[model samples]
Target: MNATDRTPADLLRSALAADPARPLVTFYDDATGERVELSVATFANWVAKTANLLQGDLAAEPGDRLALLLPAHWQSAVWLLACSSVGVVAEVQGDPAAADLVVSGPGTLEAARACRGERVALALRPLGGRFPQAPEGFADYAVEVPSQGDRFAPFAPVDPDAPALAVDGVELTSAQLVARAREDAAALGLAAGSRLLTGRTYGSWEGLSTGLFAPLAAGGSVVLCRHLGQLGEEGLAKRVESERVTNSAV
Candidate 1:
């Protein structure tokens, strides 16, 4: 971990500075036969746009709680970093009733209605396509995000000691989250430029650490796979070789 990095956003910025063209996230959905790869610059651009949406369009203030009801998809990772950039506390699969804002996938719109502040829905379509029709009372993230500014600057400086993420009933401050991520990267034997493949969900700390944060903190890249069990043995081996994966947490 960089000595100057104190938060997930800082780690991402460091990575972008080191090699913006390097692959940052390579995602696959074995269930859908979908594959997408994002370089560090591309990923940061997405994060910046999403953060602008959260901060400007949604009128999100620092310390606001955002319930993130998405799976371990690439967009989910974008939202995670966007929340950090805007100083919003991201609650993975958190209860919408108590959230100041809710970002849900197609499968979770009904539950997302409990949020009184604001609601956004993602289609999770290939190439980040828009939903054919927007869900009632919710802004379509794909439709709205495209017009947002490509650069993001938070209204106020984020406090590293403030709450940043909550998952599985555990809350972690930004600094603590980065610290844990670095520890996990070391434990996983990750290094700069290492490629880590993971088939873990984002419902637990371990899964989040391995699937996203650890690799980011270690200056490595991730091959995030969903429904990987469907790939079977031979297909999985082919993916490992094709993606040039170095470490795995499947």
Candidate 2:
């Protein structure tokens, strides 16, 4: 918990600084939506801007809650980074009982009976085309967040000892896990430009550590698959054959 250790959110600045031009995340919506990708620099700027929006503009004191309704898309990833950077209490829609805010998709409202607190809906799509207006009490998350952009000021520094994200049903402290990941990457003897293929489910602690952070720590590339099967066996076989992935952690 010393001042020296850097939290996961803190690491974002360094990651973006190191490889500002690299593509970070991509999303394909419902086959009709075009996939959008963002570079590291753009991603960082978006996060910083969002953090500023949440903190300075929103007048959100630390521990003030926000419900994030980002789906499994690039925007969700951006929101995740922004939440981490700004120190807002962000709970995505999962456990309604424990969450204070609910980020819902186009017409889907988080069930109030399941929720234990005040709820708001955040839509990821355009407004008019989307279905079902906000229920009686819930607010629109989309409209609420952008206002935060101008007012949010950056935090002084991140204490790695503080909670960065929830992992394996536990609140993971940034210092310990990141240290282990850095060390583990070194152990794997990975070099720069290594192409690392990752399984789809990276929401778990192990997945985040191995798939996202480890390869990045080693200055390697990560091949993201929504599912192991998405890349056909032949495709994966050829990739493995050509890329010469030295080792796989999964």
Candidate 3:
């Protein structure tokens, strides 16, 4: 496994080449009633398409916020990656009223509405699929938008030091995050194929940095959690034992 300093996009592309056929995300979809494993290449393609759409459909401006009220399901992966590629700011755990619109699950639209209070532009959800339910006035993310190819545009250049995520008032930049991860990973003696787990809970700075960038930088794997509820103590013990997690972030 070749390791080096690279953008998250660059790292993902490299990792896909390393194990294109390998499953990057494996989960059971309530809609499908079966397990789904999104391969590295497939996930990367969606990310690229979503990035293009974020650039084309929303025409989202850099430094602007994009609120993701998604479940820790498939689209969440796309949302995070697309935001990084486009240099758009993700205000995690926040409402889209701060943004032009909210891309959310059907269940969360009501909460989004309360947060928005008429200023929010849209509450978008997937049109078809057993995956997530869609309520009225919802713009279907699937059917309503142009084809990925049709919407496909290049990822615009970003100032690496510019704010990529607004977390607790301090903006974290792509460059700074990347640098921190690489430095920390090296210090921790993390290696390729190392199954790294976050020590901190989700939504914390430590959690975001460790779970997201550290693995990408170190050529390792990350196990994302929905909320603390998703991983009970027994599940946690089992996952660590089963996945052979290194727990380098600890």
2 against 3, candidate with superior TM-score: 3
lDDT of 3 by residue, 88-164 (tens): 77666566656754666666776666443212222322222432443554556665333675223455676567777
Q: What TM-score does each of the candidates earn?
A: 0.99, 0.67, 0.73
- lDDT of predicted model 1: 0.95
What TM-score would you give candidate 1 relative to the actual structure? 0.99
Per candidate, the number of residue pairs that clash is 0, 8, 0
Ranking by TM-score: 1, 3, 2
Q: lDDT of model 3 at residue 172?
A: 71
Q: Residues 1-250, candidate 1: write the lDDT tens digits.
A: 4787988999999998899999999999999999999999999999999999999989998899999999999999999999999999999999999999999999999999999989999999989999999999999999999999989889999999999999999999999999999999999999999999999999999999988999999999999999999999999999999999999998
**Candidate 1 clash total?**
0
Q: After superposition, how far is residue 226 of candidate 2 from its true place, in Å?
A: 2.2
Best by TM-score: 1
Which portions of model 3 show Cα errors greater than 4 Å?
A: 1-6, 26-36, 71-74, 114-133, 142-147, 150-155, 187-189, 198-201, 227-235, 248-250
Which residue ranges in model 2 land beyond 4 Å of their true spot?
1-5, 26-34, 56-60, 63-72, 89-94, 104-108, 111-152, 187-191, 227-231, 235-250
Local accuracy by lDDT, each model: 0.95, 0.54, 0.60
After best superposition, candidate 2 residue 217: deviation in angstroms? 3.5
